[model samples]
Target: MDDFDDDSFNDVLGSMEMPTSPKKPKVQPSTIQPVPAATSTANSSNNTSASITVAKPASNPHSVLVHSKQRGNPILKSIQNVPLEFRDDIVPDYVVGRTSCILFLSLKYHNLNPDYICQRLKALGKMYELRVLLVQVDTPEPHNALKSLTRISLLADLTMMLAWNAEEAGKIIETYKQFEKRPPDLIMERVESNPHQKLVAALTNIKPVNKTDAVTLLQTFGNLGNVITASEERLSQVMGLGPRKAKRLFKTLQEPFLNK
Candidate 1:
């Protein structure tokens, strides 16, 4: 019986298949796609073409605008408003760099009005530039008048004086001619022999001093004649007098006598 049982078990074991192990899940291999090639040459060429277009300069707008405006406006329109004589006066006698001198004179008178002097100056202006100094002397005389002429002549490139008559003017011209050998100082001295003319000449040279001040100072001191005689101390007491001014007055006073 044992033999039969053992043989039956062995036959069953042999007939049954051995227990199989669990199978691993199958893994499929991954596929990689290929990358596209770079377009570097095409990109570089496009950038170079763009840079060239940006480098060129544009035309100037301001210059074009100015030309357009000038074409629209005519220069003659502005010139038409000026008078013919005035335009002629603006024109120069010579070329741009040339030089010339113009002079003017104003005669003083105690009895005569400024209107007469102004009228004379205006007439004289036809030839030269005339400036009026002043009018009216406390004491009018030929010497003072001549002095005035001489003084102005020294200061100006040219001189002109108001003459009571043509004969008086001729006499002055003759006198000046005689003293022409001497310089201005000697001429002034000779001219001062006439007190009235001396006063005129002194006043004309001492122009930095006002006419009103000259008249007032002379009046306060006495007159031009006596003012010349007064000491510096006496002249210094006047309202505007200072040391320098007092000295100038004293010198002017002595000029006539010294020149004589």
Candidate 2:
């Protein structure tokens, strides 16, 4: 449901890359139930609604889920780092992470019809916490197309990614999948220079402590040394240091010297 137009969203056949021998993945046949003819009686009229059912897809562990439409795309085959499984029901080109999806777009195809992205975005509005618009610069001049998508991405809360070729996009998609369950501490700076900086870093590491509370501790007690010797009552006297945080700070600061 794109905001730009009222025309119903019909699935546009996706063929970003050239056909690769036209081999299709086998899918279980979908079944549909016929609607019963409407019946009219003197008291009331009734109509039966039809129902449809499709087989559920089998999930793989530590794997990326791909859309069947992207079967022939080079990105589908290039994701060699992690396993991938194809499913037709997904909206995005690649389901890279549990909470993330990627929509691959080619600039050359949409150069004449730029609003096509608007329709795609409308279909993908805020579905995932991390949405990536993986755009391929497939045209001689892609500046105008990128400009439009960039503006829309801001409004749609999408992370716009630029890749010169399919290989790079594949790598980016694979990276998202691999890092999905990983924590950011690997990339976080655990050490900082300067007492002022270290003070904040150290205190903030405690569950209930933060920069403001850390600064309050430093201001109330001269330094880390004084803080360590101070009683829990004195520690709790600092602004914002409630009984819990203050007791936690005192316990942490006075952790046995052998353990330290």
Candidate 3:
């Protein structure tokens, strides 16, 4: 009976008309069988041609659906949003500010390299026209924190790497005391060490003179000799040195030096 049923099925299939183009192989949903572990091992050792294939059912005939999620493109979007003028130019804000920054690292936080720090400061100072001031800060092993801070405060404008505590904060507050304003005469000796001190002193001899006038005098006349020889009219041409001050400068420059 089974042979008769199979023969009739084959006769029906052979009598049907076949399509001109090749059709996809139809897979029976019930025919998917997982390979057994023992069988897989035996197949691998024997190098058999038979292999297990996994097929997912297709919902749409045209497109293959991906299981993974997609991510937004931030870099490309940012580039698109940037202004046209700024697209090619790149400059740091600190370079434009023209302010020198010094890092005052504590011995605890960073290894203190005095020689390296001094060398860098000196080199950068020359390159940047004395605009650099880096210094390392530390309390002496035997001394109190206040004394250390006071000492370092004179050398550095800002502090870094110090532990955050009440004592440290109080020491920082105390450091500012060293920079209190004092009379100009009291700081005269300090200013004397500066190269501009002589020019400043010479300009001070005239009435109502300031530091800017002294700088202008140096820049305009080049040196003290040229300033002394400069006529009142020529001195008046310098910025900030008006006719009255120029006359006073001329008179003071021409006056004979007297023994104290």
lDDT of 3 by residue, 220-260 (tens): 88888898898889999999889988888788888889956
> Who is ahead in lDDT, 2 or 3?
2
Instruction: Estimate, for each residue in 1-260, the C-alpha lDDT of model 1 and write its tens digit.
Output: 00123353344334432212331211222232211111111111111111010111113211101111112122212223221111111111100111111111223331122122222222222222222222112234445444534443333323444434324433333333233345657535454576645555566566355656576675686667677778988877777766677788778767754543
* TM-score of predicted structure 1: 0.25
Predicted structure 2: lDDT: 0.64
Query: Would you list the rank order by lDDT, best first?
Result: 2, 3, 1
- Against the hidden true structure, what lDDT does model 1 obtain? 0.33
Instruction: Tell me the deviation in Å of residue 174 in model 2.
Output: 0.6
Model 2 per-residue lDDT tens digits across residues 1-260? 11222232222212112112332322353654321110010111122122222223437767787756566677655789889887765555677765677877766655645556655554443345677888877777777667767766766667999888878878888988888888889779676778798877878888789889988888887788888888999888888888999888888877875953
How do all models score by TM-score? 0.25, 0.53, 0.27
| lDDT, model 3 | 0.37
A best-first ranking of the candidates according to their TM-score comes to 2, 3, 1
lDDT agreement with native, every candidate? 0.33, 0.64, 0.37
The clash number for model 1 is 17
